[model samples]
Target: MSRTIFCKKLQKDAEGIGFKPFPGELGERIYDNISQEAWQMWLEHQTMLINEKRLSLMDEDTQKYLADQMDKFLFGGDYDKADGYVPEGK
Candidate 1:
């Protein structure tokens, strides 16, 4: 059976990642608090941010920005949205 976590993002128990998806303390925190569903949502949001902002993974600044966004998206008050993006059928 899959593991479940008390998801910080969703504020409920949900399916969890089998391993840490990122590195360090923050990653450990995520593994302990975030659900697989919330992580997938973040992945979609991150993709939009990367595409709309033309961010380069090779740049340290871009990496830092994404990491900050990830933390905010998961645990902070202000979640980032891709500027000018409208969901399909919205």
Candidate 2:
């Protein structure tokens, strides 16, 4: 499959998704109530993304593109959006 499709599938899976009576929202709450081990793994995987390793399995260019997209998705918009930070180069 294409890289974007593969990435999309991974994103959905990460959020505890698949065929079901409802969507993954309930799974998210279930995960919130899950054991420490599961939460630890989740944090590790999140770190991998932050470290730009989650896209390491893909080709180099695709990895860079995905990394940029992730950066924008997680860190874009107004500088004062969060409780802190006026953002860089403002």
Candidate 3:
């Protein structure tokens, strides 16, 4: 049976990730509180942030920035939107 969590991002109960995606306390927190659907949403948003900002994954500062953004997107009560992005069919 699949595990479930009360996803912080979507504010609903949903399927949980089977394991921690990151390597520290933040990952643990996510594992305990985030859902797979929310994580997937974050992945798509992260891709947009990377492409829009031209973020280099090899750069430490860029990695830190993305991590900070991830934290905000997940549990900080605020999520960053890609610049000039509009939801479809709005």
Overall local distance difference test of candidate 3: 0.88
Q: Per-residue CA lDDT of candidate 3, range 1-90, in tens? A: 789789988889999999898879999998999999989988988998998888899999999888889999989657677779765687
Q: For each candidate, what is the lDDT?
A: 0.90, 0.36, 0.88
Cα shift from native, residue 90, model 3 (Å) = 6.9
Q: All candidates' TM-scores?
A: 0.93, 0.26, 0.89
Model 1 clashing-pair count: 0
Ranked by lDDT, the better of candidates 2 and 3 is 3
Using TM-score as the measure, name the better of candidate 1 and candidate 2: 1
TM-score of 3: 0.89
What C-alpha lDDT, on a 0 to 100 scale, does residue 30 get in candidate 1? Answer: 88
Tell me which of candidates 1 and 2 scores higher on lDDT: 1
Error of 2 at 53 (Å): 6.2
lDDT (10s digit) by residue, model 2, range 1-90: 111111221233233223221136533443333333333444444454545433444578854554444333323422112233343467
The candidate that wins on lDDT is 1
Model 2, backbone clash pairs (residues 3+ apart or across chains), number: 0
Candidates in descending lDDT order: 1, 3, 2
lDDT of 1 at 31: 91
The RMSD (Cα, Å) of candidate 2 is 15.1
